[model samples]
Target: MMIGELFDPQAPLAISEHYRPHWSQAGAIVFITFRTADSIPYEVLQRWEREKNEWIARNTGRNADWRKVLPELDPRLRHQFKKTFNRLREDFLDTCNGKCVLRQPDFASIVADSLSHFDGKRYRLGDFIVMPNHVHLLASFPSEETMIGQCDSWLHYTAWKINQQLGNKGKFWQQEPFDHLVRSPEQYQYLCNYIRDNGTKANLRSGDFLYRQHDNHQ
Candidate 1:
């Protein structure tokens, strides 16, 4: 018996449909992407970032210019810009309306909060990045606790939190998630690159850069 073998030889092979890392061994590095149910324009995200940057610059007194004026912008304008921006951006990316990652404050926050479920229960979160539309994460757990059911629970719980915050009333995420067991150093590096580059896609990375990485330990 190997440390990472979950499939049965007698069963039919089903690979392309989804990626499921065998968790019998050290653990796996999972790359999960969650798009909006109908590709809603999430321009509010980018606009918010720009505003935040301007505010940071002003508060820090970093060679002020128009930024000095930015801080004083009327609250009404700020709200209006966020509202219109979101309609222009996320509306296009909110495909499926099921997993509207952009609908949330920071897609990463959804995953981070979901970790609470396993806080004192089971499993541990590893490295992760939350892009506009998806997330790449490394999670570890005792072999016994790594059952597929638990995976669903984690994702499902996160979706609920995200939907509640976004004032959504339907499915907030895709049903299936991609997973891959961390087998070798090369594989780990490859995954890390993919996660970090997630923002460059000109798509979901459209969200907040407030990405956070859980420790890479058990």
Candidate 2:
């Protein structure tokens, strides 16, 4: 039932960049979202990426290093950018794109089990849901490395198992997941509510998605 601590702005933060930048704070609760590789259409993703790059260039100047530009933005502007970026993608996810194999109870169960495997030992598991084509969860890791490593472990294991079940090959998950450190109690509760309500918002029927929340919180 440990929700962990909120992020401290003064504390040292870790920034990891791949296709996008990920910010991590040791011991702070984080909300994460990862989707199937085919969840978003290629054209749609390409367009989104183009628009994002354009926005970055307009705001931070042409060819500005995203790694530095993002972290250096005004807090309000950064929040605005992130909110819009996430919202557009989330709206598309709600359309239930891709094969949505996870809609099957058996496939979804594999992911739920993988996420719970190391619960308290490696990181504190919080509210999580296995959606049709994506997953959303909250957890706190002992260190920034643990957070990144655990996310990879979960993605790798679940993808392998699920792919084996389907006799399919190749990538199962999108390489980079979207993650954010919990900034305050309000934001933590907001994420909890978001997880709880995602299925309904996506119009997924009962048994089409798997949702779990701590009993203490409910």
Give the poorly placed runs of model 2, Cα more than 4 Å off.
19-21, 54-69
Using lDDT as the measure, the top candidate is: 2
For TM-score, the strongest prediction is 2
Model 2 C-alpha lDDT versus the unseen true structure:
0.88
Scanning candidate 2 in windows of ten residues, the lowest lDDT window is 15-24
Q: How accurate is candidate 1 locally (lDDT)?
A: 0.50
**Lowest lDDT 10-residue stretch of candidate 1:** 1-10
lDDT of 2 at 42: 94
Runs of candidate 1 exceeding 4 Å displacement: 1-107, 116-121, 144-147, 201-207, 216-218
Across 7-93, the per-residue lDDT of candidate 2 in tens digits comes to: 999998898666322888889999999999999999997898778777889876757644457778888878877888889999999
**Clashes (N, CA, C under 3 Å) per candidate:** 33, 0
lDDT of 1 by residue, 118-169 (tens): 6425655555665555555665555533545566686678778777876877
> Residue 118 error for model 1, in Å?
2.8
